[model samples]
Each structure stands twice: as C-alpha cells, then as structure tokens.
Target: MKVFGFAGYSGSGKTTLIERLIPLLRARGLRVSLIKHTHHGFDIDKPGKDSFRFREAGATEVLLAGGQRWALMHELRDEPEPTLDDQLARLAAVDLVLVEGFRTTPIPKIEIHRPAAGHPLLHDKFPNIVAIASDTPLDVQLPQLDLNDPGQIAMFILKSVDLA
Candidate 1:
C-alpha cells in the first residue's frame, strides 16, 4: 500500500484536513486506512470495563470483539514503542495509509503550517516533507497548497502517492 503522512504542530489543522480528505479519497474507490501517533497516553477501554479489568490484571494483550468490530489492545508495559513499520504491519491491507503524526518517521509527508499558530515552518528541517499546506501563502520552494481547499489537497496527496 502507498503511505503518506501529515505533520504539524498542535492546533495546526492536521486532524481537520485529514477528516476532510478521508471521504474524498474513499469516493474515488480507494480504501484508505490511518495510523495516528499521539504524544499523550490514551485509553480506548473505560475504567471498570471487562477489557480494562483484564488489562489491569496483568494480561499482556486483550481482544475485545463485538458483532461489528474487534480491537486488540496490547499493553506495552516495559516494552519499547514499536516502529512505524511494525505498527503498519498490524493494519489490514488498504490502497493508502494516511499517517497523522510520526513527524520524523521518514515517510513522505505534507507539512501543515499555519503562520497564525505561532510556529515556524517545518519543511526545511524535515526533508521528507514533500509539500506545504497553509492558510496563508508563504514564499517557499516546495509546492504550496491552500489549507482550506481539501479537494485540492486530496488530489495532491493522491498524485504524490501515485494513487490518482
């Protein structure tokens, strides 16, 4: 599967842009899967839930299955976090994988930049950044995309990955 990524600082509209792009890509008959990496610790299981209890009881992995879906939660415990390729191996096959984060993972990515967010541009530091999407136009050598134009951004992503 082709892989692409979105990288930006917090509140830079990365999630919003991805939310808009998913449907556009799906409508084109492409199966797209996403892997979002967050710096914070998170939980999908609720406290007092069976899965939560099982995990607390020292289960290394807990699989919760329902009629429509299933989720496997593996406790890292003392294990080092898995690499991007390792995480990718756990996902089902799809035409494209849109990674939302893992900025330094070496995947081709679009740097989402909003000057109003008070952050410096990242494209220069990260050579893997193939383009920049911003709310305001900036003078940069790389291809620039309007952050408000999801359609245009979606097309660019497809073309970049050769999925168009």
Candidate 2:
C-alpha cells in the first residue's frame, strides 16, 4: 500500500484537509486508511464501561464488538509506545494510508500550512515533504497547492503516489 502523510503544526488545518480529501479519494475508487496522531492522552472507552473496567483491571487488550462494529484497544502499561510501522501493520490493506502526523518519519508528505497560524513551514526543514498546501503562496522550490481546493489536492496526491 502507498503511504502519504499530511504534516503540520497544531491548528494548521491538517485534519480539515484530510477530512475533505477522504471523500474525494474514495470517489475515485480508492480505499483509504487514516492514522491520526495526538499529543494528548486519549481514551475510546468511557469510565464505568465494561471495556474501561477491564482495561483498568489490568487487561492488556480488549476487543469490544457488536453486530456491525468492533474495536480493539490495547494498553501499553509498561511497554514503549508502538512505532508508526507497528500501527500500520494492524490496518487491513488499503490503496493508500493517509497519516496525519509523525512528522519525523521518512514517508513522503504534504505540509499543510496556514499562514494565519504564524508557524514556520515544515518543508523548510523536512526533506520528506514533497509538497505544500497553503492558503498563501510560498516561494519554495517544491510544489505549492491551494489549501482550499481539496479536489486538486486529492488529484495531486494520487499523481504524487503514482496511484492514479
């Protein structure tokens, strides 16, 4: 599967761009899987729920299922956080994997940049960034795409990854 990423500082519209692109990509008959990274601690299970109780009770992993859906939660009580590749291995095969973070990884990425966010462009520092999607035009040598145009952005991604 081809792996592409959207990397940027907080509030740079990475999630918004990805959200828009997913549908556009799917329209072209591509199955996409997304992996989003967050700095804050998060939980999918609520307090007092059986899954939550089982996890709190020292179950390393819990598989919760219903007729139509199932979710697997694994707790890393003492183990190191799994790497991106490890998490990717858990995903079923798809045409593309759109990663929302993990800026340091070597995978090719599009840097989502909002000039209003007042953050420096990541492409200036990361060689793995193959393109920049921004509200304002950038003077960089790499391709600069209009951030508001998800259709164009999706087309660019498909072309960049040679999946078109």
Predicted structure with the largest TM-score when compared to the true one: 1
The Cα local distance difference test for each model comes to: 0.95, 0.93
lDDT of 2 by residue, 77-159 (tens): 98998888998999999999999989888899999988888888788788899999999998889999999999999999999
Error of 1 at 4 (Å): 0.2
Residue 112 deviation, candidate 2, in Å?
0.5
- Where model 2 places Cα greater than 4 Å from the true spot, the runs are none
Best by lDDT: 1
Residue 88 error, candidate 2, Å: 0.9
TM-score (C-alpha) between model 2 and the true structure: 0.97
Residues 76-128 of candidate 1 have per-residue lDDT tens digits of 99999998899999999999999999999999999999999899999988999
For model 2, the local distance difference test gives: 0.93
